[model samples]
Target: MIGSMPILLPVLEPDAKEGDGKEDDSGDDGQRLANRCFVIGPDGGIIARYDKIHLFDVSLGAGESYRESRTYQGGAQAVLADIGPAKLGLSICYDLRFPYLYRALAQAGADILSIPAAFTETTGRAHWHVLLRARAIETGCFVMAPAQSGHHADGRDTFGHSLLVDPWGEVLVDAGRDRGVSLFTIDLDAVAAARARIPALGHDRPLTI
Candidate 1:
């Protein structure tokens, strides 16, 4: 059984009326809160939570569309947490596309990155592997992605190729189109070794906007 539910990171949007004392209804904000992942310690207690800053919104095919920003709020802060043996960076699905977020996490000393997703079959088939490997290579961190696969009772199908990538951009394990567990050992030392060889993280200079 799961230990607990997600911790919410609330976002605030400007109200329509701007300044009439009741511009935005505070009551409804909770419904549009951030998608967060709790960093659970090995002892089964909650240590920290990272609210998903990027929401998934796209049109896949005929009669398939999603608008997460309409239903869920976007998070503004990036968080890093320690989970016993590893320093992990927390993020959800769509956040994977944003490099800045992962860089920030790596800069904060994350050895591993966890991304939990229910990725649509269409996009996942095309981009999942490439993106996950890129992030791992760029940040020199191991990536742990647990995903949803197969068609659900609601007739919605997800492409599940859950991946475990090492710091050297190697696909250590892949749970391809199956609903099961994939086990592998993560050597955190690899993170340090890879970073030491490439050292790209330290050499990046802020680009002038």
Candidate 2:
């Protein structure tokens, strides 16, 4: 799965003025930032683009810490796009932790949710499959996750096992702990059937607690 494309944006100094003798390096020649995901149409055209709202910023102990916000700016909006057969909700790695985002996408008419990730071995083993299945069951939408597996050049080991979960929370396919391609067919009609049976998405009531 392709992650977000990093784009360069100009960084401006707020305090520096024109005659302050500070270097004039604004506009087009600044820093490379922006975690953006895109939906490319069959015609090789851009259909939709989404910036990843959630950034991975945590310390897993053992001196391992990630500060994604250091170089990349988090996205502010969630994007939904129509890809012919199904309306897709676009998201990147860390977005899986937030179920509300998936629920909102389903309510907004998204039938398929794409969450491409490179999860660490620790968290993936603990929560990956469970979370993916839960999301599908909760939203009655198909969950398609393509993950990065095995070791990388950066000296970090990733947890693989890419999964495709159906609307009923059934795992249609799992890619195991290695890097490989997996194929599976989904019935979009099942989305409606599952939601019809549970009807939980429409059962929300205001809470006073």
Candidate 3:
């Protein structure tokens, strides 16, 4: 999801469809727009927009504390978008730690997942890559994560290893703690192949205690 910002949006109609995202004149304005991601399709129109569901609210003692919920309301819905080659699921940084959400998206036919994160340097260094790879492996979906790197003007640091992980849990590209771009061709077939080989998504059983 794009970083935090207060956005003013127009009111939406009840008859609104999925292909185009519409907002209106009777503005609904606030910090809701900040923590969201949009999937633009081949035709250059907005196909889907997913608001970030999980907020980062943790007290990392020694004065290192973050309260994302203080700024914005978390999203109440999960969205999967049609992006021609694959059904892409949208989620933000903190949501990556929740596997059940990814499983729900996969069940809804998502073959590719996007995580746009502004992760803190401490936790990102420890859990970022591994968690992303695990999600890809479990869902058999290609995971594309674009992250915020280096330092922000507020004197905070981010662990900026923007990763592209394959369905087979391979690191295709890692944008390591630098302000730059990483581009690669995503082979959709790899998703199919990996899922066919492992089929882990199909093996899920009910949680029985």
Q: Which segments of model 1 are wrong by more than 4 Å?
A: 1-30
Q: Which stretches of candidate 3 lie over 4 Å from their true place?
A: 1-34
- Per-residue lDDT of candidate 1, residues 14-52 (tens digit): 322223232344445435555667765545667887667
The residue pairs in collision within model 2 are: none
Model 2 Cα lDDT, one tens digit per residue, 28-136: 3334366677677656567788777787989999987887655555667898988776799888889999999999999999999988888998889999999999999
Worst 10 residues of 3 by lDDT: 4-13
Give candidate 2 misplaced runs (Cα > 4 Å).
Answer: 1-32
Select the stronger candidate by lDDT from 1 and 2: 2
Using TM-score as the measure, the top candidate is: 2
lDDT (CA) for every model shown? 0.79, 0.80, 0.77
- Ordered from best to worst lDDT, the candidate numbers read 2, 1, 3
What would the TM-score be for candidate 1 when compared with the true structure?
Answer: 0.82
Judge candidate 2 against the unseen true structure and give its global Cα lDDT, from 0 to 1. 0.80
The Cα error of candidate 1 at residue 9, in Å, is 16
Root-mean-square deviation of candidate 2: 7.4
